[model samples]
Target: MSMSALRRGRKAVVALTTALAVTLVSCSAGEEGAGMGEQQGTPPSTDFFGYQTNSRLVTTNAGTAFGAATNAELLASRLYPAAFVPGPGGQLIPNSDLVTTQEITEPSPDAPRKILYTISDQARFSDGEDVTCEDFLLAYKAGKMRELFGSQKPLANEISNLQCAAGFKQFVVTFNPGQGERWRYLFGPGTVMPSHAIAQKAGLTQEELVGALYAEDPYQLQEVARLWRYGFSVTEFDPDLQLSYGPFVIDRVGPDGEVILKANEDYFGDAPALEQLVVWPRSADTQRLVEDGALQVLDSSTANPTWYDRDSETNPFTLQSQPGDLTDTLVLSGYGLFSQQWARQAFAACVDQGRLAQVSSEKSGTEVAPAYVHVLRHSDPLIPRLDPVTNPHKKTDMELAGQLAGQTIRIGYLGPDERLAAMVQAIKESCEAAGVTVEDVAAEHMSQIHLEIDPETGLPTIDAFLGPVDPMYEYGGPEALIQNVSALRVAEEKLWEDLYDIPVSAQPRTFILDRSVENVVPYTGLSGIGWNMDRWNINEELAGQVTATSEETSEQ
Candidate 1:
């Protein structure tokens, strides 16, 4: 899902290729205008619309839509900012335009581990600022080391230090012993911001910010944290502060939640294919918009969740799909009525994982397996299976769940899709049969609960929520899966307290492309579906047809 160069489309034919196979841009001047051009086709637009249901486009991947389709990496690789790009089979592909080479060293026997990245001098931000280690430091502190600023705990907490060894072009990342096994992927999905712009916004010199990063100054960190957390939001998008180091930069955010990307003429890398790219946040009517020629790419999230469930082998649009790495799974909150471990266990035992997989996949017309682990894929060998006598997805036992029938437990989730809606109802019905009350809660409210401690009660606010549980990466291997015995015990208490994550289910992403697109490849294992979208081109014949229709409609 990385469009960022440092880390990590479709249509027409029904060609079947394997999924392991797997983009352009300018510097400063954007297109004259940014519009979908569905209104009329006379001066037909080369503009394209890419849709995704998840609103989150950040790199932390900590909130709801954790690995949501609109990942910041996906946008960065396709636009301007990028570093060591991910290639086929999870290989690190360095962007010659930015980074020169990257190397990992274990250092001396007693020294800490390190990953050294040397950048090309030609790199420059859209604002004309030189790409520097200061940018990386900002991303690392704001995202991976968030605890320094009293924010939500950061992911990838294993990285001990990140600093510039020489000029801004060269940087070094030191890993904590027994941590950061996946150091190569550190900040891979994230891009560096312009320290100059961020510093100006925070009323500090770029040098001061860089110094603050190195010293971890408590006072300066608070302001840096403020800018890092909210500076790039759609509502708060600032061309100056949220500057682009990638090929494409944000020109404007539309009232309709449309993010229009214009080329950065100052970009040192390859230019973007299409002059104007419009990202359309997915909605129920997204299908109608594409069918009506208002959109060109069904390249993001599927509203139906079953949009790929076509019963036939051939689909109207070109299709590319691979078994994805991120899992869309459910999480039980350790709050309110679920404070008791047995209560969470009882809910797990009653819900049918098979039913969830069945109903959700019935749309793609393709059946899928259910998930059953915390940090490992259900199909991974290291995952402990829970079938036979230990399985929890069975019919509810009223006698066993009679701990309390009078209280209600609210379940939280994101998006407005039928799949989740169906799962929620199913979970409620199953739990009700076991004498427990269940309610639905939107994921937004639950995000606060997951990241923040309530000042009033000093505990998470929500009763329970459904969110994606990232696979092992922050920690070296699957060891984190079963790490702390005491923590595991408290999690599974009820002696059985050593386990808390009730294994539910996981689903991979299925990509549907429009009939008029090309140069799109499907990739498996983490770089998600759109690892290479910057090079995607449109089919003239099919594209022209839509233009003709638009022209005819306007004349009428």
Candidate 2:
């Protein structure tokens, strides 16, 4: 179906749903899909259904987690922390539920920059503990310069100090000797770890945890860092240790790897309308499940549908899609032969990014464009390109990479990804011709390739891997501060290599949602679909129908 025709069809769905009142769905295992009662056609169940990506909902390892720590966790974190949450329009805003006042001062010669984050006395977690200044301090220290995990990401790094008033609600952040962008945005949507909970888990007093951050005591710091880095893992999620301050708290991690969040009745802010929010993984065909009403939001990224295949008219909902902020690229791990700048540049030049984008667009029926640099959002004036872009795919550079003949560069990718596979194959064929042997290491999933390794080798069985070339870290976010990442380079054994990203295509997040659901906002943040889930509402009667079905399903 044509794009315009599909959009017009959505008009009809909007009209039909105008009368439905706000409603939501619930889950308790064995009672999920039966939410529509005995309706022949799956009537809009009150449940507000959405989707999740690869089962990695909590791992911090970039290779296996798909960056979920920064993305998916935002949904749960938004409830407790009031500093920042992704707004409906893609900008960061203070969560009114927790934040009472947010002040951003203009930069000047005398006092360059400043941000004040003040949470409400009413702010509290699911367990009824008050949200305090110490929580934000924990996030700032643990994440700012990677003092804990021994990695260097410039997030939450700029503040010279965080001074809090006696009550601990009003916190003032003072800048260091120089102003930093990561410092600018960190306060915009700052993430806070539960200081009280972390202290309890680490067997330290609340005073000790905050004191450790202030004193930078190696002994106490290491204890806090251990939990921040590895404690909240979804693989071995400990509900008690992973307490939440959000509107919904994680009740359990399902056997199938779904993160199940139950309503946090003790929450300080307005309770979320939905009692049970289940972020489920797509088990089989996504489009079919969405068509059957088993899924409410069909993420285009996971569905991997092309433009021509993007149809919303025949369905009962409006397809709301906006450009995603991610770019497709081949990130060459600068390990072994790829460590040299010449070697990295030579192989990067040979891969036909334009051709790769074209092939992908044709396969997915979407328009694809080639990216020349890391940061491509025309919206941000930051990171102005200094060089002109030209294609090497049009002309071969066999002579350039000929220096590394007979060198085997192992390239790994998520197996069965048709689009990625195509890009990798093109890269493989091009690199191989230049005398550099390209070993394509395909894995069933990201964990298989990234987390697992041969013991004897002591190296990632592969030399290089392919994934999104994060432009933000370079000039996008904190990495923009300066390339002073030698500290980070030393932490990771294999990931230390200079990253060489060859931009392939610009892929956007697309979604098809039921008309019965409201406030469907498209966001370009880490929490892709759930960027504005807090504002999502459903139809009242439909929710009742879903509840009845659930009760019935539970009985059987």
lDDT, each prediction: 0.53, 0.53
User: Model 1, 414: alpha-carbon shift in Å?
Assistant: 1.9
For all candidates, the clash counts are 48, 15
Which lDDT tens digits does candidate 2 get at residues 99-159?
Answer: 6554477766576467777777777776778888887777666655353443323444556
* lDDT per residue (tens digit) for residues 1-556 in model 1: 1111100012211111111111022222252222232233222222344544233444322211232323444444444334656676555677778776444675554777777777778778777778777777776765555444433323347678887732467887887765554555455543455667778778887778878777777687777666665565665666667566666777766544566677777788788775666565543244334332344455443323333334433233555544355555555555555667777666666666677666656543344666654445455543443233234433446666656576676666664555666677777876787677877766532343352346688765556555444444322332334454333223223322322454455554556665556666665334444566566666667655544443444345
Query: What is candidate 2's CA lDDT for residue 252?
Result: 62
Candidate 1 overall Cα lDDT vs. reference?
Answer: 0.53
Q: What's model 2's lDDT at 307? A: 22
> lDDT of candidate 2 vs native?
0.53
**After best superposition, candidate 2 residue 211: deviation in angstroms?**
3.2
